[model samples]
Target: MATALPAPAALLLWECAARAFGLLYFPPPTSIAARAYHLWFSGPPAHLFLTAEAVEDLLPSLTRLVVGWTLAAALGLATGLALGRLPILAALADPLLHIGRAIPPPALLPLFLATLPIGTPTQLATILAGVIWPILINTADGVRHVHHAYLDTASVFQLGRARRLLYVIVPAAAPKILAGLRLSVSLALIMMVVSELTASTDGLGYRLQNAAGSVDVPAMWAVIVLLGIAGIAANGVFLFVQRRLLRSGQAARPRGHVLAWQQ
Candidate 1:
């Protein structure tokens, strides 16, 4: 609800609200700002840009996020395509996939930590395992929803494997892929932080936990705000990409003529 405000009004409202009551639970916004500022500026390393305290904290999280999500995307898309296009595979795997996807990923943290490598590698592997299911499941769903007419047209043309996949399958399945990507992106960030909070020595999540333990509530709150801001910014970016992919996919088609339509 607060997001609907015009920028000026939002700032004003935020200031007023914080001044009125925020100190009861959190430091007012200014206290959070002071903590954020001191973290980034009150240091000699500022010239190196790692002076930002959370640089040390945030980098590991970002690293795990990027690596894990990329792996998930690659594997998920491949698996999803097979599930969507192959009847026997879909029949065999769909039920299990549904059940697996429904299970919360963090519940497996104990199992993962027991078997996976330690430190950064373990964090990344944990994030990947946790976040991958949404991408895989959504991509499969999207592939299944591909327009039937498109498949029939490809059949009529007797398209070769390369041509069929390049022209028909990928294009037809793109909107769904983009949707799945959005879900996976959010999942990736969540898992990245959760992994850190659970075990990693460094990360925004770790710092937040550390600050809380030290009773540095203002710093903890600042980190939480940053996480919220990061989530918003990431979704904005995903939406921008989604618009481009959707538009480009549409533009690639001969919308001017309908008979040759193939997804």
Candidate 2:
């Protein structure tokens, strides 16, 4: 309760300032909230109070974000695991990985646009290009640093390769992989908006662009607020899943094994 006061207090101050100054561009919070609700949330009860614009624009952006992020996460985890397990492969790919990560995803958007269709495919590629590096690097680092004792235990049990990877290696490295995933969520959202900002007909970014062009400051603020809410919601969901997975992983391990791994 105490921690939550600051945000509302700050918003109240902002509202007072905007109203006092009669700022056209920076509208009060109340007005912005009203605009946002009308634009995206006001609708028939059958559609869960989602306006047609929200259904058309917001849902597609969210779909792209989820699909693109999932693809990046899968690809990153697989490649990272292989690299972590094989020093030779890691060595060979090290320079390439460094170079690839250094290049910004948006810089390659032109190439993607030229090659792929100006829709989901190109958007996904942009997201994958940007979001994969952190997950890959973090997973590889985590796996590499896993306690050798764990591996020795698996070997003593004569665990097959698949079983060893699934049971021992993945759980051990999950913390790092999850950290990478957390970072990638934000990157995925940014890429989603950027991918839709140009050569696109629909999505939140397109709506934002149109609002700005038309000088609809309140609408722009509404979109910005919606994006903020989306980000917070995404992070909240990830944290919930992270906690559940970590707890389950700990439960599955032998007593004191997690402490030993931490040490």
Which number leads on lDDT?
2
What is the alpha-carbon lDDT of model 1 when measured against the actual structure? 0.79
Off by over 4 Å in 1: 1-24, 45-52, 256-263
How high a TM-score does candidate 1 get?
0.87
lDDT of each: 0.79, 0.91
Error of 2 at 170 (Å): 0.6
Task: Indicate which candidate wins on TM-score.
Answer: 2
lDDT of 2 by residue, 195-220 (tens): 98875688998999999999989999
- The parts of candidate 2 lying over 4 Å away from their true place are 43-46
Q: Which pairs clash inside model 1?
A: none
lDDT per residue as tens, model 1, 84-129: 7788999999788878777788887887789877677667777777
